[model samples]
Target: MTNSPDILSNTFPDTPQRRLLLDFVADEADALQRGEQGGFWPDNHHLISPLIGKAGKFLDEDEHVAFFHHLLRLDHCPPVKTEEDFALLLRAYDGLGDLMSRGYPVCSLPFHLAVFLFGGDALARLPAEPEPTLASFQSGVSFLRYARSFAHMPGIMSKRQKFIDLSADRALVARVRKTLLHGHQQLLDGLGRLWLWAFVFLVLQVEEEAQPVIRKIREDAAAAGDVKRVETLERFIAAAGLAR
Candidate 1:
């Protein structure tokens, strides 16, 4: 993954916060290396569990962005392989999300893209049997939404577009459509509308099978008093000529 020089330079200006984040990244990298040498995998939750709150206490916006970028880069050298490795990646993604929720401008697009890619790979590698748990499916959908938010960014948009196109494959689309249609009511209440909107926007081709789902999402948004989201969904539906 190429780093944006402008983002790097702006994020790493000579500041106390910059030094602190850099030091933290260096320490985590060293720890990971040592753990690998000893044939021991570090628990991601144990590693970053405390820093969830501390990151907010110490890092400002630019520092937060720099910290996440450096930590994410660690996975590049030795790509995540095992379930434990993926858990570590998810922990890092969660840490970044925590910072962003606290008003820190942690450019989380890359991390979201990483999560989407890794999550899909993990799913594909799973043994065929009972379906993936709702929690797992929800997690994948959540990352996709985050990546979608940055679809206008350079390079990132193309990757997201690729994922969107792949997701439109007939078998996968049919499976996801069935899952969404028959999913638990509580799960639908929590993430269904957003997932529905994303699926409709990204994968579906405004065909007859897609119209009812689109209408349901629009109704859900309106009922929730999200006029802006409702309007956006309406525009997408109309633009796709899915609306009657």
Candidate 2:
């Protein structure tokens, strides 16, 4: 497991390329916040693509860790102006997600934070009645599912719950519930249940509101003889002080 404090304190070596990329990220963020158009936006793909390609070529684990941390830190600037700006913010996250999905030895904490940050930005850029397309919702859910491997790690569960707390609105949560209910039956198994539980308990927050879905998941786990999953749901219910 990666030490959060160590990652936080780590910084990349001061090189011309590194300095240029960092400056571009800050400048682009400022330009976007000022609602400027067409200045360096067109150069984003050219500039960021090479960094993504070289991101994994660091000399050591410490360098690798610092690289990702630096990229994620760029997202701390002011809010973006357009979908293009949002896409720029997600470049590092998308690269990290791709790395993890390819079975790289990336730390789950940074990856999870990247996913959550990207998802928040993506949702913010959406219209009020955004379409429930797979692209629109899957990034957040997929990241939550991926983070399950580290669920037992300290602070992971609360972070998962916090992501739900931060990203969920009524329409988004309802759409997620509907998606999980209709065809994504696989999401109810194992750590997926934890994802569901977080959504139900943290996002939905009312026992009455959550009971039906919780009961269905519990019964499904029982029938499938998934004792661990059944216990997980029960513990969630008990934690919430909801009547069985």
Candidate 3:
């Protein structure tokens, strides 16, 4: 845990973190199931709690790692050299559209899935020589867009799939349940809490960048009093963490 800059610092969907985010995603299905079972699931307010909680946990771990190890040193890594490069890295990942329909676990991470499963072409098209900043901003934007998209999945999925089918093969209910029961001990080998911490580090950073854009989108929606947009933003924020 000492300051080792060699750690891969890149950006979103830091595979490990993405895995943790996906794990939390299981809760949405669980909450829907509980609600159906007549449990006292609150309204949207109940939804945000899980997201913030999961995100907070992830962030807490990331902070610890950073405190002990320092930022990842990816000097040779071209994708995260600058903000633009970051954006492009994420934009390049737009390829996940195909995978999302298949319900791959990566789909749970949305943008990361897009970047991981779909970014080949964009990446290939890079300035042949590629600049560190070329895609960073775009990638950041993609992260924001994808983060926003998370909010819709639970509501949409809840409506689309039956609760039983959603949680059929699952065990955990809310994120709290999963954390309390397994902690990181249960995560699959090579990918567990560490991965999630990376994700948290990346997103918390991205959220800082995304806030202005997200706020702009919200303000635009508010100016027009767009109820749908507000709801969508709320859902996106909530779902981004798989908390709600």
C-alpha lDDT values of all predictions: 0.42, 0.43, 0.31
**For model 2, what is the error of residue 39's alpha carbon versus the real structure, in angstroms, after optimal superposition?**
36
Model 2 over residues 142-234: C-alpha lDDT tens digits? 545544444442334445455455444555454444433332234354245343455544433454346556766766777778887767666
Task: Give stretches of model 2 more than 4 Å off.
Answer: 1-129, 132-150, 153-168, 190-197
| Between candidates 1 and 3, the TM-score winner | 1
Best by lDDT: 2
Ranking by lDDT: 2, 1, 3
Candidates arranged by TM-score, highest first: 2, 1, 3
Tell me which residue pairs clash in candidate 1.
none
- Candidates 1 and 3, the one with greater lDDT: 1
List RMSD in Å for every model shown.
14.2, 14.3, 21.1
lDDT of 3 at 72: 12
Worst 10 residues of 2 by lDDT: 1-10
Model 1 regions lying over 4 Å from their true place: 1-22, 25-168, 171-199, 206-213
